[model samples]
Target: MNAAKPTASLFQRPAWVALFAFTAAFAWGWAYPLIKLGFAEFGIGRDMTGSKMLFAGIRFCLSGLIILTIARLTGRSFSLKEDGRKSVVGSCLFLLLFALLNTTLHYAAFYIGLSYSLGSRASILNSLSVFALVLLACAFYKSDKLIFRKVLGCVTGFLGIMALNLGGEESGAFTLMGDGLIIANALCGAFAGLMTRGVNKRVDVFVGTGYSLSVGGALLVIPGLMMGGTLHNVTPWGIVILALLIGISTIGFTLYNKLLTCNPMGKVAIWNSLIPVVGAVTSCMCLGETFYSKYALAAVLAATGIYIINKGKK
Candidate 1:
């Protein structure tokens, strides 16, 4: 008889999981600078909320379609039959709600906030999502209780966030349109992270993510168009930038979803600390933004917090 096959993919291995998580974080880090560059290339201005929405919509919508197409080719079913006695319509409604929370509101807030904030500062602030995820996971998952270490970690991390206001263009007070909206984005993202665990139990991660992106993106596009949104200074380079953004969404979300499905939420998410560091450094380097001393302090604190959280309970 032939030997039994291992059946597990490399991604299932702990080391591989860590590697993929880092890679996903690194790719997302680049997105901050690239997005700013994209804005400039397409002639998108800070006040052009409509155009911003439309641009983000196209990137996510195309990402969804590409992911779905790949899933189909790999023979993954798109059925929600496993989601229990809920009708197909009910399942779809749930998905739409998820899409709204996951993609539409999430990116809508992000794009708007980024327009008003510096890429470096915005990236660091976005770490709010990571901290939110830890707490949310504690609330939702019995396995992810808030240990002393976790609490300290969160406190330390929040200090890093508070430090953001001490330097740079910010005047140490939150702006309603800028910082508030980004915090809103972080809340949406935290909820989405929790929701993905439940989603993966019913449907393939790729399928759920695709529908969320596509439908939510379409929702953004409609409002954007109604608001007279239009892309300006479209060029080959702009198209390339858009394509890169799409790839970032596709690859980053897919890997993240898979990791969340397979690992403890806190374990998987603690690595997100790397995001602000990568994002801040890359944004300064790529966008020529000033790297303030406070930014480095924030990154260090954030990294230290993550280390404590990941150290695990004795």
Candidate 2:
């Protein structure tokens, strides 16, 4: 009578998990275009880091609030209880730290990076998290050791990723916001990924997610407003796009992190390597950018690399 075991077993099915992963990844991929579009719709200038962070703050804060509400109203354990009453205090403390690292730093870097770079280029560069995670995991966890197969997979994936930038256009955008900040975003994600493991062990995920996002959003919003940030000319379409952004953050994070809970990190993250490819393709179509023949080839390489990495898993 292992009730939880069956749920775990169901999630363990590779096909089911992969399907879920793809759906969430697809939702996330749309963010590149939506954000670029949102910037236009909301009158957010390219150099307006304050406005950019304000928008991000709103997106994450609302998403977190909605997610936490859903989980709580549905009778899920949305607060820290397993570790007793005293643990709630500690849980709140952990959430503050997590919010600072995960949402505040990660999105501050991401928004600033996006402001300076094209969505397509940012998409490609932001996914360096996969490679960063491989290194960090190998260094921190004995269980996630590196082998020839893993190395080969990483190389193949990275090569394909780099190939996306082979076109002169992609290469030309390399700058602080283009590559450096995106890499920083990736590193922040990797750092948060490690912290998530500890958070899951000690706190209710819904509560942590809610607290961190709310706190982080407030933090960003304060500074942004002080810096003369204001969202202007919001039309109906702007509301729709902002709502979509919130949906993506809430649903995408829930599904992706749930997958990481039920499956191995490599299994979850390898599939995520496709985010950049998906983002690039989506951006070209929606952002009025031209697509090149080499982009298709790069997508194939990235997909193949994901398969190779997953296949190498024991």
Candidate 3:
């Protein structure tokens, strides 16, 4: 990433960069519809309970291997050692903890939550990570202070979250399957982000991410299989789609991270608003659901909050 920093600056060409950023962001957004389509194709449903986890496990595991392969082909280091001279034990330990926090627990809850929730709702609610991380960082890191704008931003974001849940008993009420699971998923993801910050100083960033995803995802498959999840309904076309989803994860994450490493964090961070926006819109289209004005309002509030947080001075 450091060596490629110069080239990435070329990507910072305002118009072209915006296009690249949106395209990358759209790939992540694509996951919303693709995951649902996977569920439908495999005959998985909310009632299946374990199938979603199983499906996510496969996607992450495959994506992880793909990433690792790319890293190796590009001659990137996977060493856990900060300076490439650490013991095998230390490296193994780093991979273990990273996999646990970043992939295993995080996606288990996320996929399950997404299973029971509307894609549009899931996209909006999952944006809670920004606010949640603000609070988490304040508690854990000396440098991350909460000021007036941040607090106000967090409030605005939370209000947007509340707005999404106001329709009625069917859509509004929190269930273990809906709001409950997504909130848990967001917390886990925030922690994972923090964990990444910590471990990046100790190991190769790409290596840690790749290995953790592979290990954690493989572990998820165990519980899913024990819980009776199966991919018996998958077809050749479904396999092709699943492959596409994995490609999204692999390419989307790498590019997003690379851009962040190469440019101003604020510049890259603002593009994230596109993730939920694209996810909600595409999910609505895929589900054949009508667009509601509330979704727009929610997206704006949440996006504004994220902007404020990232734009804060150090």
* Cα lDDT, model 1, residue 101: 89
After superposition, candidate 3 runs with Cα above 4 Å error:
1-24, 83-91, 170-172, 257-270, 310-314
TM-score of 3: 0.85
Question: Tens-digit lDDT track for model 2 on 70-133?
Answer: 8789787755656535677776677677788778898888888877776776776666777677
| Leading candidate by lDDT | 1
On a 0 to 100 scale, what is the lDDT of residue 275 in model 2? 82
Clashes of 1: 0
Over the stretch 1-314, how does candidate 1's per-residue lDDT look in tens digits? 99998777766777888898998888988888998899999999989999999999999999999999999999998877466235666666777878998999999999998877877888888898888999999988898888898899999999998888885454334687888888898889889988887777667878999988999999999999899889989999999999999999999989988888878888778777888888889989998888888888888888888888888533
| lDDT: worst 10-residue window of model 3 | 257-266
Count of backbone clashes for each model?
Answer: 0, 0, 0
The per-prediction CA RMSD against the true structure, in angstroms, equals 2.4, 2.8, 4.0
- Report how far residue 25 has shifted in candidate 2, in Å: 0.7
The stretch of ten residues in a row with the least summed lDDT in candidate 1 is 167-176
Rank ordering of all candidates by lDDT, starting from the highest: 1, 2, 3
Whole-model Cα lDDT of every candidate shown, in order: 0.86, 0.76, 0.75
| Model 3, C-alpha of 59: deviation from truth (Å) | 0.5
* Model 2 misplaced stretches (Cα beyond 4 Å): 1-9, 81-93, 169-171
For model 3, residues 125-203, the per-residue Cα lDDT tens digits are 8878757766776677676666877788888888888778676665545678777888987787666655665455666
